[model samples]
Target: MGKSKVYFTNMHATIKENLPQKLRRLIKTAGIGQIDFDRKFTAIKIHFGEPGNLAYLRPNYAKTVADVVKELGGKPFLTDCNTLYVGGRKNALDHLSSAYVNGFSLLSTGCHIIIADGLKGTDEALVPVKNGEYVKEAKIGQAVMDADVFISLSHFKGHESTGFGGTLKNIGMGCGSRAGKMEMHSSGKPHVSHSKCVGCGTCIKNCAHDAITLKDHKATIDHNKCVGCGRCIGVCPMDAVQPASDESNDILNKKIAEYSAAVLYGRPNFHISLVIDVSPYCDCHSENDIPIVPDVGMFASFDPVALDVACADAVNRQSVIKGSILEKNGHKHQDYFTDVSPETNWRVAIDHAVKLNLGNKEYELITI
Candidate 1:
């Protein structure tokens, strides 16, 4: 495959051209206008930061993307699926509240915020993964799959699990329904944490397969009956049902690639990643640590894999920020992501994405 063109722009802004305007220029130069968005529903996928974590991309950035989509006669909405973990964004109501608290109101973004997976994180579309190894059918949020065009407005930053959350991570993991996330994170089904279970039987009511039953007032999953659809996890009121994080990091990464393919297949998709705030952990956390490196810049591409590789390369070239996690951890691997998260190998996702023909790893970085 030929090297995909990834457009880049530094943080430096002139007096006349500010950061958001520069971002608009970057995407336009990157050929986002190539897609015909006449009256189409465009899902601008983004992470509305968890309630207290300030590392997430601001609503202004989302507005820029939304405004561009509107300019092309597309109906745009900011979107993200409910998170798997217990946090501010676990369900749609809480997730919307969190987004609003974090400044992602309709007024702020110039687009409505849709919690993709519906109220309980159960609303989903079963999308078949082409040439998939780990997943045959991916469970993505219904709203995301229903979109006419998909655009990822991602915040490129450190992730504890995937090594770094970029375009693929944002699309794959972010677009997945609750069940989809459980599949990517675990090889096995979720188990009820007896300590957290209140014997409410909410899981049993929601289970379509009769896989869950109350044993001595605590819910227990019958593995034989359970299809690992992760419905029980979403319904458990006390957060008793916990997905097993047994999948190897490499396998998890590959599965994420497959999921990404499922989301973007046969669709008009564009990705933009802002490599700023460079936090040590995901925005899923309520607290964000200092950046591990200086703010890199904004990047846009039609190719998610190449976009991620270019962002990683840009981040690696920067000097580690003093007193941040990367510096404190001693940069042992010479790769900043690995130095901070030694257990994760982000290359697995890129390699699998390449094998899946999602995008080329080689890219021509064109500065705007």
Candidate 2:
């Protein structure tokens, strides 16, 4: 009902202070611990970098937040949903391996990793959002919906589609199961390319409702049986499955907002975004481009929308890296995401999320 506060701190460190302490202070000052955490199942939603992408957040930062939650008697687990596209993180085992390889280990962060979607990325809970745009309920991963509290630790970086992946992006899309992600990213149907299908039956095995079948030495999808959950896309050994149309970037962004609304329903949530690496693409890529700007520090807020807006505003104020993605246009007087991906306008997600009553767009930036 009142102005939301987004706590921030720059990369300023002197003899009397350090960045890690500053991060904890930012979380505390944002009132994340005000929620009851005793014996609660807390899900710290985060992206465990695709192995080989070195731009992800260090596990030590996760440890800091884990300590805070543990002190409050909450059972915290670092979690993320399975990917929509085929990759090393398509299933729980490979996903966990990628997570640990990326430095999110029990020894590193003092928490276990859980792929929010089940083994094949089918575990989900349909959360009904009675809104004009979304029509019905959004299907989110079961573990995320089952959690008593939600904490989104986002790596704020440039995205190919959404312009940026901030707090809302981290929770909304990041919390979705592979099918949920497919729903957000595209409107067209998903299909399995028979040419690429090796008859391996990987997709058939993973399909929850037997929507995929092998016919004439190839895999075929029965759209009637298929709920478009996207598991087949991720599990195809031959990389056969694909979304029909990539969907418009604006619709993709709006879907992301709807997914975020599903994630915030009836839960105590805290969000932290680290605007570092400043890469031009998502960490889903195996490679990361050079940083497009200096490392902006951490931000925390109870209001995910305000937190994202503050992070974007902070990134926009920085100068672009000399030879990075933003250098091509001589550092346009706008956010680097728009400069690099002109086709994408990241603000649409923020505006739409605000319209959904997720949180306010206007926020007071408090430098902690």
Best by the lDDT measure: 1
| RMSD list, candidates in order | 1.0, 1.7
Tens digits of per-residue lDDT for model 1, 186-221: 878889889999999888998899988888998899
lDDT of 2 by residue, 1-368 (tens): 68898888887887877777777778888888798999999999989998889998889889889888998899999999988876778888899999888888889999888889988788898887747285267879999999999999999999888898788888888888877888887775699777787888887877779888889878888888888878777766678888765778888888888888888878899899998888889888888999888999899888999988888888888877888878976656466788888889988988888888999988988887
Residue 206, model 1, lDDT: 89
lDDT of 1 at 303: 97
> What lDDT does model 1 reach?
0.93
Q: List the residue pairs that clash in candidate 2.
A: 179-229
What local lDDT does model 1 show for residue 234?
72
TM-score for every candidate vs. truth? Answer: 0.98, 0.95
Off by over 4 Å in 1: none
Error of 2 at 37 (Å): 0.8
